[model samples]
Target chain A: MTPSSGASARTQPLDHKEIVAAPRTLVLVGNPNVGKSVLFGALTGKYVTVSNYPGTTVEVTRGAAEIGGLRWHVLDTPGTNNLLPMSEDEQVTRDILLREPEYVCLQVCDAKNLRRGLLLACQLAEAGVPFTLALNMADEAAARGIRIDTDRLSGALGIDVVSTVAVQRTGLPLLLERIPEAGVSKFRPRYDAAIESALSELEPLLPAARLSRRSLGLMVLAGDDSLQPWLASGASAVRLERIEGIRRALASRYPESLRFVVARQRLAAADRLHDQVVTRGKASAGSALARRIGAWSTDPVKGIPVLLLVLAAAYLFVGVFGAKTLVDFLENTVFYDHVVPWTEAFLRFVVPAGAVQEFLVGPPGLPFRETSGFVIGKYGLVSMGLAYGMAIVLPIVATFFLSFSVLEDSGYLPRLAVMVNRVFKWMGLNGKAVLPMVLGLGCDTMATMTARIMETRKERVIVTLLLALAVPCSAQIAVIFAMLQGLSFAASLWFSAVIVLVLFLVGWLAARVIPGRGSDFVLELPPLRVPQLGNVLVKTLARMEWYLREALPLFVLGTLLLWVLDRTHMLGLVERAAAPVVVGILQLPEQSASAFILGFLRRDYAAAGLFQIYQPYMSTGTMTRVMEIQVTVALVTVTLFIPCIANFLMILKERGWKTGLAISAFVLPFAVGVGAAVNLLMRRFY
Target chain B: MPALVQRQERCPLCGMAFDAEGQGCRPSCPLATGCRVVCCPSCGYSFPQESGWAGKLKGWLDRRKEAGR
Candidate 1:
């Protein structure tokens, strides 16, 4: 599924006259991609760079702007569709709102897509935050023939409202005119009779804070424990009794869920307001084309073939195009032609001493190429760094990021999640856990972080283990695909079968160890759209920049660390110690020792280093050896290898060291056991 | 405090149907969309409405237990 990097509307730089003196705040709130950023830049006169949120797989941008004689803190929050935020991005937006600020929130709505945007607006209203209704993308609304009466909307909503094509700077004047007046306006969330009665009882007893008395009263009634800190110690006991009294009086008068009851109260009110002010002429976003594609992608009859096509696309892009084409140019033309020779000559010119020069430039050996291994400083540095950064890892990652961007943009990934839910349930994982697993195929590091979206600790651990054991990082996948590109179809077919069997088997086994009721995956499926190349490029470049910064140093540093270990003979000692499991369990040669050693440093980098060993000296026995080595290395390294430095830091921050280390411990021996069984079976068959 | 489990029959959240060894009781929720449920292991969100009753009873008993009653 191509990532829908949604269309970012054009931005115009601001002028001095638009700058306001008094400091105020304007918060942009809405559904995904209604040109909030475009409006944000236009408002603030600040270059709001796009980036992801910290410690999670989501992003937000905050900037400064001037509006209505006030300098405002303009924040473009993560696109949240409804009151309940499911994703990390959505959670961040909610988190921001929890921090009560002196600000006017502009709930930006796409005139063409107001129904979806209004859900979140209703949530803001329920929270009783002061906000203006921004009917953004007015041109699109005009095209779609959605006519909203602003005066009626304001009257119905009991707040200031304005329409604007935020991308085109259409309604800034009117929006600005209303901002000052929005300072103290209140949005009272309509609650059902029972909860309202309960709140009325609690409100007088409640202490004052940033949130409205009614809002806090309702939170106390609904039992949002995030409000726990401010409450008196016996607050829960008191609140529970009151809530129970209300419930007893009500006697299942509402639905089973307090959450749904809350939403229904707000939604009914929003719908009534919506009916008064807005008239929808036609559907703009959801088209016949979208339905056809969506149907083909998610359902069983056609989804299988579509899934295969996507996998095949990944193989072709990373293997055939990236590794075969781009790497060849960079490796052959750029590095070989210029960087290597110059670096060698420069080292000779400066270092003077032969050993010192060799340490810096060339490896200490006769054939020269033979000396280029992971342990020798220069050879290891040049080969591993250049290869990982520019040659092999880069283009593969670029294609990967590009494909992910397209899938994200197209909005097909949600459907894929729906389809995979059934298979996931069989493995004792709920369907909701499937997204991180599918995303696991892209980057295990990010997938691990994405696990927080799961409701339970048990689900997070299961998904984390599955990711570490089964999923190959895109870079490692590129090397494997390229290495096996020459193998017979039957051999490749066998290789594919083993991995699939292991994924299911391992997932099932892990699920048993950490069993719980998986969260219900009631996700909002955004309509699929054609991926804009502009969005794709920006998204791809940003991720590539991150991947490059993340992995490149680790590549070079891993080489240097290995070099030091080799020099100290610590590596040899460890390999000798690990030899029994490495050889006896996996049944491979001692020469494959270096690959195993490098695997901890970097998975794909290690695979690339290992590939050169046999690709040149290809023989019949070597094929079996290669397959064994690849499988054993892929499985064990994926699971057991110390998480590359980036993931380790996040694990510490999110789960703490004890849980993170625990995950690694379970992975190591389990990976080896799986590898041992596979090795024995393969040898027996042959 | 951890919440109550109203269901004495099959646990919908567990993805398990009614078992043969049924604890000599029945548990059901008419509001459940399906037999399967995503019960909060910690919070017991999947419990039948009887959980509200059970929770109150348990709290009273636990207070007695703590007081050596």
Candidate 2:
């Protein structure tokens, strides 16, 4: 029968009788965006219902087609990341397989992303599903330096396999002809003895259905909650209770999630299959540029120049464009020229003269009082907090986020990790830690949370300490860049050298002190592709929204705290107490002490305070090399100071209070000591 | 419905497909509707979710390649 006879027919769901009467049903399945729908459309013509699954909003489409003289019902299911459901769509896809056992599986896969596809294929094999593998996007895959030996993959899986460019409708006829050759995959995954025993126990309890008892048992072992309905339909109360007991017992054996353990095995199997069947080749002309860049990105010898280029670009974009250009316009032209003057005049008019107006906008005759401390004070909520958050930090972080999105989309971050892996080895960390370290530059709190990806507690602790101590967050980086951009490049270099030296010294010491060894880095590098601008813009906007939500309240709260401290006379006392260290040790101005104390509240806030004191000389329109050494020393000190309050809380949550407190205890004195040393040394040279 | 049929975005590093709505740093975020950072559900790598322009550009490139073929 010709499945491609016509495109005129509209798709309709097969009635129960027709589904039952059909010779066979071919179900199309794969991970999301693997061209399953396109393949389904190619085979079934225009007949389809691409809508939510029954009784749920997860998308699933079904249609009917004639194949090999038999009317076949086609079930186009939602893309499942894994065979066992992690989300609603995955759940719907899993349910379709369990409920419709008579269907033959037609697994569509992205040719360039074979490993992930094979992970699901392994699940299908374990489930005893008769299936054929279609490696879709064959052309695009070839362009991106990927090639798969289909016959080898077929031999390895003991199933029919075909490569198809589904969008172009190439290889469809051949794929159709091989549908009859579909069979239960011969490949079977081996599980640990505990998992095996658990499967056996569950096998006997499972009711006869479309799914294999082994598959169902594995799902049960993995703690799939959605399986309850299926179990309730056929399992007795006693049997269900026994299964739960078995599951709990199995779960108790491991500290980590058992699901990940099982997934790791499947991933290993997929890797082996990939090694046996896939090959890398030269990319086409369209992708040659991306391919070469992708290679250079991970190659240590070639990557340095690429990395430098990237850093220079970032500095120019965030420092010059965002911080200098945009911030100048917003702060000088918009806020200083319009908002501050307007707000001060309005407050002066509205509030009757006396203590209220004086306190609200700061006392008259106080220099910069119109812009400085209380809610309405010159440094108050609107002038200081809003101006800093909107005019300065926002543009810098927006540019940073945009750049980050570009790197992430181009698949360069992983390559950077690979290149940095050698250096990380000296710190007793594998390349995997690079992800969190890189993320720390964006937000240390988020990076600390992401530290869970590290296999060892020792690695996590070390990385956490490094993040809290040395990494200057995106906001802080913006402020530092804004401050230093006006000064000499030597100051920037000096600041960077100190941070890198301190990071290595601390990380090395932590590695020697920590009890455990780190695991080797084994990461897959993705093919490089052109970044999608709309996607980049979206990510930038989302990150900016997150920043605004997280930072604005803190800015306002910080202003309030400063006001309270000033009111309580505590600010003067603390400044006096800190004066000796600030003046003698660090050799910084007395006012710098306040910025150091505020640094604990928010790193960016402290940096903003520094910006107010040391902005580029207005007449020269540039920061003089004047006191450049002092500025560099101060920046380095703050960069290495104790974590911000938010970050400290995260450290406590992730690593417990003792470790958190210990990290802070160590970082504070170390930061001060380094600041003193840097100051003493710089004073001699500059 | 056609517009809802988004192009599949895969993590460049791990090769995992992204659920445009579900995966990423802030899934339930109010700003998530317009945000395109498609995080890999399997691996933690986040990549920008592709737009229609990318799809159209790819199609155009593919057509040119096909003509050469």
Pick the TM-score winner: 2
lDDT of each: 0.60, 0.75
The prediction achieving the highest DockQ against the true structure is 2
lDDT of 1 by residue, A43-93 (tens): 656545555655566666666555544456567887666535444666667
TM-score of each: 0.58, 0.62
Clashing pairs in 2: A1-A69, A11-A47, A11-A48, A370-A378, A371-A378, A371-A379, A372-A378, A372-A379, A373-A379, A526-B12
Two-chain complex of model 2, DockQ on C-alpha atoms against the true structure: 0.19
DockQ of all candidates, in order? 0.01, 0.19
lDDT of 2 by residue, A1-686 (tens): 33443322335655545644667889899977788888888877765556667789877666777776668878888877687775677888888888874778899998878987888899999898999999998998887668788888898899999888998988877788778669999998888888888878778988877877888888888877889888888989998999899988988986535675577566667877887887776433456577678878877799999999988997788778887898889988998788876877788789887888877776665544433436556458767878877877787777877887787767787788878877887898867778878777777766676676565789889999999999888778878877766677676777888899999999999999988866545455666777766556655565555556556777788777777877898888888899998878888888878888788888778877777777646236655454677788788888887547778877877788898899999998888899888887777775
Q: lDDT tens string, model 1, B1-69?
A: 112333423221221122122221112322122212223221121222222333355455558656972
Misplaced by over 4 Å in model 1 are A1-113, A119-288, A300-302, A332-342, A345-353, A362-365, A372-379, A427-434, A486-491, A619-643, B1-69
